[model samples]
Target: MEIPENYPKKYWHCHIEVDTGGKKNTSAIFNDLTIKELWQQVVSPWHTHRPFTVDGTIVRDYDKVQKIKITQTEHPQSYYAEQHNASMQRKGIADMATNRRLLPLSKGKDYTHEFLFADLTMNDNEQEKVVSNNKIFIVHGHDEQVKETTARFVEKLGLEAVILHEQANEGKTIIEKLEKHTDVGFSLVLLTPDDVGATVTDKENLKPRARQNVLLELGYMAGKLGRGKVCALKKGDVEIPSDLIGVLYVEIDAAGAWRLQVAKELKVAGLGVDLNNAI
Candidate 1:
């Protein structure tokens, strides 16, 4: 076969630099040949061997090296890309670690220690798993302590809570995380001044985050699934956005006594079922 100039073919070349004999030792060299040629070169000086020939070609086992030369370097992601990548990697590591121990002990031919599925599929599956695992509520409000306390209250009812605090911290942005919540069966947003003000105008001059990521998420749920799948959890003091006038909102206090009530709301929303429990 004709080898292309760009083909990355690597071959093993062996030679001996040390020798021992009755007289002074001599060095021998062999170029681009098999182990047999190397041995012959070492032994030929002494006239102690018969005819020798290399048995095989070194270029035969170079597919991996060849492929490596053709592979492109991986490019770094933008800010958003980095956020999504980190989230994906984190979830992958978590799922792999958790499922690693549960994997079958049998040495079956089909069993594998590492899974090589698509990252998108794994992430989407993780989101679905999260939604079905427990009742989840997305709380957004002006007062950090108040909104957080409400989420904590929801957690007290044995539910999942994700409090999108108004303060933009060093963590992942709201839009980055919301895209991964595909199977988010139910969500609740606490619309406040900070949440609305943080939104930026897009090229279309539309306020994407006007209601915060919670609002974008709600819009996604409404458009994809329907309006019944999401709720608005707001304190009585804040004015509700005009767009969310008809949506349901669960009002909670800072004392964390409303946990059971939030759990009841989640049950009413039909997101209290655990779908991943069987697997």
Candidate 2:
């Protein structure tokens, strides 16, 4: 077999000889094989053919075996490669633990931990204390009327509305500011028809749409907070984004029916909302 130039220079060479009393020994030699590959290609097949007894019970259809012997020799290059790999694995694990401990609680959500460790353990009450449940992030576009009205309604529900631009810039970029403020438990996306666009082929047939920034923030909020915790308020003749098919979109009609819908969504998302206040 041709080996790639980057392949490990050393490997365990294995020789297996099986003697079933009736016949001559059957033997095979494999060169440049990893320990796992040696077991899978050679040892496992023999074990399957003649399974060892478990709890003094014989497996069905087991082959009668006399003697089976396996010999393995590790090349010097392979031994060094194994040692290097093991050391790197140990260092990687240590670095991951250190990084996890150094990351702030707000940024910890970005990392995925497969197993629970002592440093990462937190009770439900502790987690609730870290994340604010009463704050609602409002992702708005160019429509000041809709933005102000939505902010007012959110505040009227006895909850704090987090408006991005209203917060101090603090010498951070827009995305950085957004990341700092997205710790809220819920988000409200205002999809006002602030722009118009159409496919390249049908440039003349433009349709009203929300600003690109609004859609970008909408997606970001939906991902940060789950779709159930994010609600989109469509105002006027704005075209709904096709990608957000499963997300909840409430119509902001002139008669003010959207307030009740928003209040219901907030209540379902574990926010304290007074339905009567919405009406």
lDDT of 1: 0.40
Residues 31-103 of candidate 1 have per-residue lDDT tens digits of: 3333233323322211211112222211111111111100111221133345445776888753333222111
Candidate 2 lDDT over 140-244, as tens digits, reads 989899999999999999998999999999999999999888767689999998899999999999999999999999998877666877899998889988998
TM value for model 1: 0.38
For candidate 2, give the lDDT of residue 63. 36
Candidate 1 runs further than 4 Å off: 1-137, 163-174, 193-214, 253-261, 271-279
Assess the local accuracy of residue 11 in candidate 2 as a C-alpha lDDT between 0 and 100.
51
Q: Per model, how many backbone clashes are there?
A: 0, 1
Global CA lDDT computed for model 2: 0.65
lDDT of each: 0.40, 0.65
Q: Which predicted model would earn the best lDDT? A: 2
